[model samples]
Structures are given as C-alpha cells and as structure tokens.
Target: MASGFCEDCSRLLDEFCVYLRKVCREFEQKIRDVFRELSQCTCFRIAPESSFLRRRRRRRTQELLSLHLLCDDETQLLNQESLHALSRLASSEDTDLQTTAAMFYLHVSHHLKSSLPDAFMEPVMALLLSTDLDVQKTISLSLVNLLAKNNVCKELVIEMGMLVPILELFQSGDAAAQCHSCACVTLLASSESKSEAIMVDGIMPLLALAKSYEPQVQQNATWALLHLTQSDWSTRILCEVGAIPVLVLLLQSSDSQVQFYSCTALCNIAAVREHHPKLLSMGGHFLLKSLLTLVSSSVQKNSTQACRCLQTLSRNVLIQEQLMELDCLVPLKALLKNSSPVRRESAITLLSALSAHPPNNDVLVSEGLLEEIGQLLHHQTSVIITHSCKIITDLCGSSMGQQAVMDSLCVSGLLGALLSPSVSDETSLHVTSCLYHLVTWDPLKSNLSVTITSEQVSRLVRLSGLIQNPQLSYNSAAIISTLAMTEEMAQLLRPHYITMLEYLLVFLKKKDVKLQQLGILTVFNLKKDGGFSSLLAGSELEAQLWKVHAQTEETRRLLQMITPLSPSPVDP
Candidate 1:
C-alpha cells in the first residue's frame, strides 16, 4: 500500500500533506515488501541497506517531482507550494526524512551540477554547503548519479569552479563522499580542456589525498594522476610533484589492488618515450623486479598485470639493457611456454625488443632464442604462429639474425601461411611483411622462384589491386613491385602486368585526380623494363593513348601515354 502510496504521491504531490499523516501507516507494509524484494537485488546484498533503501524509493519520487517543477513553465504557480513543502521537510530532525529533503532540494536546485544552467547556482551551493555529513553524503551521491549521464557532471564542475571543494572532500569527507567526489573530478578531468585546469587547480589537493592512509583516496588519486599525465607536459609536472616516489611507495602497499593501479599509472606515464629514463632513475627497476617476482607466486590476474608492467618498462631502451644485465630474459623466455597464449605473445614482444640494437641482439642470439621462436611456429595456435613469424621477421630484417632464420625453414612455412585463403588479414599482413624482409635479404635470390607460377602471379595481381583501399594498396603495390624486379621474376609477372595495365588505362580515364596520379605512378615503374612497350605496341593500345605523347621528354617517352599512330619505339 505504501509502495502504491509513493507512486501515487508523485502523481498527487500537491496532496503530500494529506498523505503525510498516513505515510507511516501505509509505508510500513510497503517497507516490508521493499526489504523482501531487496533481499534478492544485487545492490542490497553487495552493500546491503535496510533503512536506506526503504526510504530512498519514496524520497526519489518526491525529488523527481521537485525536479520536474524546476523545469516546469508553470513554476510560478507551483513555487509557493513547493517551497513551503521543502522548507518544512528540511527542518525535520529525522535523519532519513532530512536526507530525503536534501535530495529533493538539490534536485530542484539543479544549478549545483551545471555551471551552464546558472538558474539555481547560488541557492543550491548554499543548501549543499550547509548540510551535515550524512545529508551532504546523500546529496552528493544523488548529484553524482547524474554524472553517469556522460559529460554532464564534467561540464557542470568546470562551470561551478568546484574542483577545490571537491578535492577538499578527498581529504576530509566520508568514504562515500570521497569516492563520489573523486569520481566527479575524474569525470571533469576526462575532458581534454579541463584536465590542465584540474592539474593546475586540483593536483596539489589530489596529491595530498594520494598519500592519505585511506586506500580509496589513494586509488582515485592515482587514477587522477594517470589521467592528467596523458597530456604532453603532465609527466614533468607529476615527477616534479613527487608522483614517482609516491607511486613507487603505493606499489609496496599491502593492498594488491592499490599496487595494481599504481603500477598501471606508473607504466602509463613511463611509456611516454622521453619520460622513460626519469621513471627508471626513480626506482623503476626495483618496481619491475618486484613485479616480475610476483609472476612466480602471485595470483594469475596479478601476475598478468605485473608482467604487463614489466613489458611497459622493457620498452625503454636503457631499462631493457639493464633487464638483460640482470639476466631477466630467462624468466621472460620461460613465460613463452606458459599455457596462456597471451603470456607467450607478451614474452615474444618483449624478446623482440632485444633486437632493437646490436648489443641486445648479441645478448638474445647468445641464448639460441631463434630456435625456440621457430618452435612456436609449429605450435597449433595461429596467434602464437603469427607472433613467432613477427619475431622472425624482426630478427631477419636485421643483418645479424638472418642466417639462423634461413636455416630454420622459417621462410617456406611463413610463405605457405600467407598463401592460405583462410588466414586472417592480420596474419596475412604479418606474413607478407616477413616475406618482404626475407626476400629482400635473400642474397642468392634463393627465396625467389625461378618461374613464378601462374597461380602465384594471379594472387599477387589480385592482392595488388587491393591497393585501391589505400592502406593495403601502397603496401601491396610495393610487394608486387619488389617481386617484379627479379630477372626471371619479370617474365612470370608478365601476364599479371598486362592485366594491371588494362585496369590502369581504364582508371586513368576517371575524373578522380588522386586516383589518376596513383595509377600513373603504378605503371611508371613497370614501364622502365621496356616490356610494357611491346605490350602497348598494337593498334589496341593506340586508341586510348594520351594526345600529348611526343611532348614527353625522351627519358620519359616509354611511360608517356601514347598519341595514336605516333612512331612506336621500334628500336632502342
């Protein structure tokens, strides 16, 4: 009956006084129903609320009505009734009713959340500032729920100039208030324009809380720092403000989650290419050692995160060398055999970084790592095989790693993988990329087939046409271009080249200026062989040839589109 009453109360809010006397009598039955239902709802079980949930649903009805009144064009007519009801309810000493009253007032005073709708700003701020801790928490949480609407909270916080008070809550408010305030600040800083302002105005306050004994404050503050550091210069500011040492300290916290977020924040900031050394100088290696050690004993979730931090730290050139000196490669290599393909891929990616320089390559090859990577290609998983192919690609692209790869049969297997129609685009890209490196480095042209089979030429030609997609086009063209440059290779490509030119001539007549330019460049390189001249010699070629044929310079004559009946290049 009381649940029905609250529903009716919203529809008949003007009669709230008549219903007020019966609220207790009717609310009892409804309250029981609510708790009975609440026993099943996740929120009530997760953070069970008996008295709070019972009252909230009713109060929410009133608050929604007040909010509607605030936007009503009929506000003048309802103003007197609404204010009298709110004023009476606000003066009530009962905590739950007062909490409800606070929510109701803040709802109507929507100016608290938005700087743009300056409609009720001063009044709402005064009401909120005057509320006691319990009421303040209720109102803040209620206001914050609106934040879930997307950039709503962020825009308002910026307009209200409330970062300071919100940050003050981080130091002094209840956990609920602090969490919401941190969340609000997070929403605000998410805006690129607002981030710098928060950093300048809010960082000091956030830093104080980041060091607080409270884990919640520390977690949110670390997140805030992470968000701020996404900007170009936020790193120097964060480091100067002692964020590095604090993060390192947080990494040592007894709380695993705190350590996780702090490590993540540190990794994000450290990943910036130049700021890397500073992160390392400030005990980054010690943190990485700690993270790597966790890989052996920690839960799989935590171990994965620690491994990721290790990978992020490994991206630094100087830090990677230091890791090698510490002989960390054994543990990282050991992870390649982990049951998780993700773990193995991460290990491969980290190991690939060893090829970044000659010294690192020396360290890696001395371990006979190429053979292990080649073994991964034989593993059943495509992901593993793809990553292994990538590692082989990176290694062979360098001068030092070629001989081990060629001897491993890596090239043939990878080529077969590329030709498989079922291979994903990503795998194909990696395989072709590896092929490019392997073929270009093959000193004897041993990798190049003496007779490029018709099937291979047709596939290359089809793949070459995909260049029109722009991304794949240039890369596909370069691959075809490379394959065509070999001596016997040119003869095998002759049929495909003829087909490509036929399409190229048609594309040239199109009005797309960029496409025309790309088409011309494509044929320009092919015509250098003078094989294109014989193909274009017939009267068939004369019909579509350009009118400005003879005007082209002597050196470019073969590439210049022909004028019909112009003297064909009969001799050199």
Candidate 2:
C-alpha cells in the first residue's frame, strides 16, 4: 500500500512540474485553467492524507504559485497572476495556505514596495486579526514591511483600522507576535500624525509590554515610548503613568540596545526639570553607571546620547555629588577628548555641573580637567569655548583649583580667550573671572604680571571701557588693579588713565563692597606716579572720587593720595 501511495505521489509531482512549465510560458489563461483543475484533482488531495502528503501538497502549491507570482529572472517583482493568487490565498480559511500566502506577500511586497495596491491592506488586516498565532505573526511582519515601504501604506494601514488590533495582539499573542506588534506600533508611532492615534489606542499596552520579562518586547516598547515622549504632553503623560521606574529598571537590562533606548527615553523625560527628582528616586544611580559605561565604550552615537542624558541628570546638585562619588569623571574626561563635537560639548556641560560644588572642583582638578578645558578653549565652535571657559572659572573658585589653573599655565589660555574678539559676553565674563582668581593666587600674581604683556594691559583697559557686562567690567577692573602693581604696567596704563578712572568711578559708586574695594585699589595703582597723582589732582574727574566710601584705611590712604591735600593753602 505504501508503494502504491508513493507511485501516486510521483505521478502528482510530475503533473505539477508540467503545469509549472506551461505557467512560465505566458499562457495566462491556460495556467489558470491548469491551477483550477489541479485544485480539484483527487490525486492532489487523496483520502487519509498523511503528514508527508500534506507537506508535498503545500510545497507543490507554493512552487506552482511562485511561477505566476515571480518573474523568471528576479524573485522580487510579482506578475499580476501571482498578486491575484496571493490576495485570494491571504484570506483563505486554510491555516497553512494563509500562512504561506502571508509569508510570500512579505517577501514580494518588499520589492513591489509602494506599487502594492491599497486593496492589498484588507486581506492582510483580516489575517492579522486571525486567532492562529502563526498567521498573526506572519501578517504582522508583512504589515510592518508594508508600513515601512512608504507613507501611503502606512496611512492605509491606519485607514484600514489595523493599529488597534495589532496593539491588541500585544496582550494575547506570544513573544514573537508581541515583538512584531510592538515593532509595527513603533513604526506607526514614528509618524508625527500617527503618534497621537497610537498613543490613544496603544500607549498603555506598550508601557505594559515595556515591563515584560522578554527583552525584545521591552526594547520595542521602550523604543516606541521613546518616540511618543518627543512631545511635551506625551512625555508628561508617560511620567504621570509611572513609566519612569520601569524605564529606569530597564537601564539595568543586559542588552545594550535595551539599555540604550531606556536611557534615551529617561533622558527625554528628564528634559523637564521637574522629573529629575522622580528619576533619582527610582534608582538613577544605576542609570548613571550605565551611561558612564556606554561612554567608556566605543559606540559614538550611544555614548553621545548617554552623555547628554548625564548632562541633564547632573543638573541636580545631589546627583552631581553622586556622579562624582561614582567616579564619573573618568568617562566624562574621556568624552571631553571625543571626536564628536556634540559629545565633547555634553561632556563639558556635565563637567561644568559637577564642578559647581567645591568638593567636585577638587575631583575635577585632580582628574586634569583644567587641561582638557584649556584645549577646548581653542575649539572653533564658540559654545565649546564658552562652556570650557565657564568650567575653568568654576574650577578656579576653589583654592586647589586655582593653584591647578596657575600651575597648568591655563592662565595664558584664559588671557588669550579674554582678548579674543569672537568670545561671547558670558565667555568673556568667565575668562575675566578666571583671570581675577589667577591674579589673586598671590604666588601666581607676579607671574601673571610678567607673563601678560603691556600690549595685553592696553587691551584690558580697552575691554574694561567698552564691554557692558558688570562682572566683566568689575573683574577687569580688579585684574588691572592687580597687574598695575608693577611700575611698567602703571606707565603702560597711564595713556588710558582717564578712561580707566571713568570706568573705576562707576564701580566705586556701587553698593557692592568688592567693587568699591577693586575701584579703590585700581585708583591706588594708577596714583603711584606723582605725575598721575598730579594729573588726578588737576582733572575735574576728582569730584567723582569724593564719593569713595574709604571702607578700609588703605582705601582711605589711597583716597588721601589721589585727592589734592584739600588745596590746603591755596597759596593766595
């Protein structure tokens, strides 16, 4: 009996091969008639079908189907007959046939791409809603392909009401189906217009999927959440729905890709300042460690994003301390030298935040952060230069940082930066503050006067006169006061004495004690020359001098020297 069955199967296979040859010959009607007759032939579907017979029948059907569907030379382009057969079989009740048709459509649709008709969406959607897991997975993959092919299919998928059912599969389907479903939703959510609808129908399911034990589901869902959170409202919504802890937990995921998306989503959520505390409460320490790890690795894009996320989270002072304690400076310092300008800038920004606290300043200085910042000062980008200068200024706030700046000879860079015409007002202000700290370092004071030239002094006088920034103006006044202790600088500054006096008088009139003291000291330096004092004695500018508070006795004596001894004995 087995031998008889084998013979019958051989005969059926021979007939199918002959049919395939005729179909390939462009005899469209004849091929259709052969397929119709073959579908009804008893030999093809014999009684008491065994698994082997079923496999043979399906394979032969697929072979015959390929003739009408694919071109003879290329498998991608579908002939009209193959597309019609696919459309029909896609909705077939036979589970295996529908599965085969969906798989074939997935392969060919990639090639035909946008050329696939709008009507093709209906059968795919029908099969997508099928209860069979295999059929659903196959159709879900095909829909993802279609949606990715072009915007028209994407819109058609949404128009044909496929989004909700696919999202529904996230709950009922197995891991593979859930992954594909989340992937499709991820694709749809990428469209700005489609994002709102998917969020309405799918955000909760996606958030739930984000917590799945399966990594792919978590990856796809988090990726989808990443897109949805691009809008401010959606970001707030996600945070309110408590996506923060879940995303934070995903940062510990063993998969780097999962860690990446989770980090990015948390980064977006943390863009709003209010979310910072929430993220910290949800084990943000692990997030910091994960990001620092990514930065240490060689993946440039992920490292850049991780740096950005760290930059935002580091804004909180407590977090900054934690980052410092965790030795985040190592990775951040490495990123400072990164080839990517953005990552370098982000590293600089995070370092700037970390440097805000005095103890962190010591950590940064120990890490050679000043040299990195000095290198950044020469960067062609203005913002990098600006932030680099600001970080130096912050570091210089601590005494150890001051010695480090002076010892590193970053002072020359700071001076050059201060003199650069392209420097922003903020950058100029920071450079001036850095200079102020350097000159006040006592041990570095004389070195500064020696290293800075008379020409640079003249530039400082001009900068003090023209710039409108109060801090720059005040620090510039303080630097001149410190630098003019040398007679050479005093003489070089003599040429601009009137302008310097006018600028000083503005600060001398302020309620700020520091500015008043700097103003008095600068005037005292200029008064060293009997010639300048005599000049001060003669000019009408001395009237502004009377308003000086004489806060200290040195100020009092300096006032006495610059003030004409009360025209005592106007020897009339």
Candidate 3:
C-alpha cells in the first residue's frame, strides 16, 4: 500500500543517519561532498507549492525520509568537535550543508540548552536567515522546541534581535513557515522579559495572526495573548491596542481551545476597572452570553476561568443587571453544588456580590440559591462555609430576602455553623451577622428563639468569644443587644448572666458609638432581672456613669435607664 511506504522509509534512513554522524568523527575530506549532496533533501518542500493559502486546511508535513532521519534515536547531538565542523559547514557558501545541519538539529538543537553555548543563538539566527526556504522552515520549528520554557534562550534570541525576522516570517511566510514562526513567538511570549521586544515588535502582528485562516496559527496567536495579558498593565495595553474586539470575535471560533484562550484573555482585560466601560460598549451583552456558556465547560480550568471572568464583570453594577437578565444564577448554583474548591469559592463570592442588588435577591432565592446555600453552610471546608455565610448575610439585608431566607433551611445551617468548633474567626463573623439580621427582623421578633436557640445565644454571650475577635464581638454584641430588646429573648442569657455582665462591661467601655449603644441597651436589659442587678450595678461603668459623657442621644437615653439602680453589689 502507498501508506505503508512511509513506514519502510525508516529502513532507508539508517544508512543516511550513520553516514552523516560518522562524517563528524573521521574529518574525512574525500567523501564529504558525496554525503552533503546525498543529504540535499529533494523529497519534500515546506514552502507552499503555490501562492494559495486559504485552501490549506492542514499544516503540510515533511517527507518520510526527514522525519525518519531526524527522530530522537537517529540524530546524535554535536560535541565540540562536530559542533566546530558543523559550524564551518553551516557557514559555507553552499546552502545544502546549512539546510542539512539545520535539519539534523531538529533533534540536536535541544542540546544547546544543556549548559548553553556562549553564542548559542548565533547559529540559530544564521540558519534562520538562509536564502534556502528549507532552512528557515526547519530552524523555525526547531526554535519552537528550543525556546520552550527556556527563558535564557528566549532572552538570547530576543537580544540577538531574532523576533523581528521571526515576526516577519510569521506575517509573510507560507503555512508551514507561519506555523513555526507563530509557535516560536508563542513560546517567547511566556515571560515578562519580552515586553520591551513586544513594544518594538508590537502586538498588532499577533492580533492579525489571531484571525489567520489556519486554526493552528489562530489558536497559537490567541494563546500567546493569554500569556501576554497576564499583568493588569499588559491587559490595559492590550485593550488600548484594540484587542477587545478581536478577543470578542474569537469567542465565536469553532475551535474550543481558541474559545478558551480568548475567554481567559478577556478575563484579564475585563479585570481593569477602567476597561469595563469599553468592554460594555464594544459588545458586553454578547460577551456575557459567551462567558455564561463557558461557565458550564467540562474542563475544570475552563469553568474556573469563566467563573473568574464573570466574578470580575459582576463587580460592575450594570453587569449585575445584565447577569440577572441572563439567568446567570442557574449555572452558578450548579457550580456550588459540584465543582473545584476554587470554582466554588468564586461562585460564592460572585453570588454574594450579585445579592447586593435588591432585585437580584428574589431571583437568587427562587433559583434554588437558598437551598444550595443551605447545603454549602455545612460543607467540609470552612472557607466554603464562610463564603456561603456571606451570601446569607447579603441576602438577609432586605425584608423580602430576609423573609424568604428564614422560610428556607439556610437558617438552621447557619445555627449549626455557629456551634461547630471548627468554624474560623471569619466564618463566625459573617454567620453571626446573618443571625443578627434574622433576630432583629420585626416579623421574626415575636418568635426569635424559634429561629435562634438559647444555646446559640449563650455562645455569643460567652466572655472569651465576645472579646476574641473585633468583628465577631461587634456582630455578637449586635445580635445579643437586639435580643435584649425583649425580656423573653433576654432570659436566654439568664444562665450566662455573669458572662453577659463581663461582655457588657467590656463593650460599655469601648469607643465605637454603635457598640457603646448596644452595650448600654444590653446593660439596661440585664438590670431588669433583679437578682443580677447588684453585680452589674457595682460595674466599672456604673461607678464612672456621671464621668462617662454619652456620645449620642440614644446612648444617653439607654445610659439613664441603668443609672445608680442599687448601691449594693451581688455575689459572683
């Protein structure tokens, strides 16, 4: 079969590989011309056979002989002896030896990175500049492999001014040459060092290549921009260069990776707050749809990136409405149900931010967001629990949202988190804040204990817990103070009376006006129970009552309620 002929070509290449490697050893001057001409490479050509490019659906492949000859096992890397010999041959007026040596280096060039020759890029540039189209195509592809993850070589190539020629080849060459050229540029673009070269070389060429008819070139160019836009400054620069429109179009590409790279690049561009308005004006609605579609991507990083991009966009208040109109909460809830920790956390934060808009709240609650959060509040990771609690806190800010949430299972999950020993300080802050929102709601005030148990109240009033973290202390004081507004909820703290006295005394001496008022109100509530009145009466603030000048009318009114109720102090 004609197809089997390619497999047999490896058998024919053994003689060529052996003869070529042996020539480097003996310094045989007589047969050098014969071997050089035998390696003349007439079997295939990488340059287009014609000027037409759009019909070239696939990247052209090299001949079987070269692929067989240049394989990993067939090519021996150069030592100083052969390196000098190849150097002399490489510099010859004959283009065949330059092409021959460059072909062998498809396997050999990787060795240059081992310890790195002093002028390693010199021959790379030399071979790349050969008038022979064969040499340019071979070395360009080889340069792709050589420069990969090797910043030192990348810098050497850039400092040698190799990019302009590579960019030229990328811009003007045939399919094979452009593929290699774009690849080399893609590898070189991975670090911060290329900014200066890119400044001079400019990204317009890459933007042009992103729309290349060839998928590989298009895919690579788009991917390179993903790396280029790693920094906010570069992203801003890319947007200023009109990258947003190009990225927007690539989102419609048939290639999945192209779509992915374009999505992340836009994520970077969208991260700049100033660029938000531009992204909106350009095609913000279409952009949101593209991102929302990717949010359900099967690839973990794909969805992670999409979620991240959405989170950044959600920060803009206008985009929040767009998101709600798009029913964005549906996939976000799915992500919360099952996804990576990173994706889940991002989804949580985005949902929390969206909950800030009053209208988005009802949409979220109806979309099973409350049910998802109910499960997340009991997740294994405290960070998940923390983020979930934040959504509850944000949603609980509104009367309609508060009523809807209290009717769901989210409240019990929150109460369970409050009693869980593993909860972090941050989780405690948000979770306690949610509890405050619920207990203080007027409709819920008639039956506050049904929503928050007395045991949870006692935990909030614990002296060590109250003074432990400032935010927790504030929320705890707020929750306990709100409860102290009614005697039924105040008696929830009766067993922990001494703990409440110590907690109240701690806050009563603080400077925060809200904390001062909450502390004074709780002190007034505790005094209503006569048995413990003496212990709180001999308190430091009571002793300094007249000396304490109230900051607000509310604080002064609450302070006057507890002024000198009794002279005697009770036993601890």
Ranking by lDDT: 2, 3, 1
Of 1 and 2, the candidate ahead on TM-score is 1
Off by over 4 Å in 3: 1-124, 130-161, 164-219, 231-242, 252-256, 277-284, 339-343, 358-368, 380-390, 445-448, 463-468, 484-495, 510-516, 528-531, 534-572
Q: Relative to the unseen true structure, what is the C-alpha lDDT of residue 437 in candidate 1, on a scale of 0 to 100?
A: 61
Residue-level error in angstroms, candidate 1, position 550: 14
User: lDDT for model 2, on a 0 to 1 scale?
Assistant: 0.72
lDDT of 3 by residue, 332-451 (tens): 888898847777876787787787777787778767687788777766467677767767766776666677676777877877788888877776777787777677776654445556
TM-score of 1: 0.59
Model 2, stretches more than 4 Å misplaced? 1-163, 166-201, 204-222, 230-261, 271-286, 297-299, 316-322, 397-399, 505-518, 546-572
Evaluated at residue 213, the lDDT of candidate 1 is 84
Task: Give the Cα error of residue 344 in candidate 2, in Å.
Answer: 2.2
Candidate 2 local lDDT, 1-572, one digit each (tens): 35555777989988999999877876878788998788778878835668997997886587556744464434344456665666667666778777777776666546553466665566677788676888888878877776667624555666677877888777663877877886787676555454454455557777788888876667777777887667676676677667887887776677778778888887888788997777777454776776688776566667777887888887777878888889887788887777878778777777776777776777788888888777766663666766766677778777787777767757677667766778777667767776776677776677688778766777778768753677777777778888745667666777887787777767766777877777777778778777678778855446656645334556777877885655557673
Best by lDDT: 2
TM-score of each: 0.59, 0.57, 0.63
- Model 3 TM-score is 0.63
- lDDT for model 1, please: 0.61
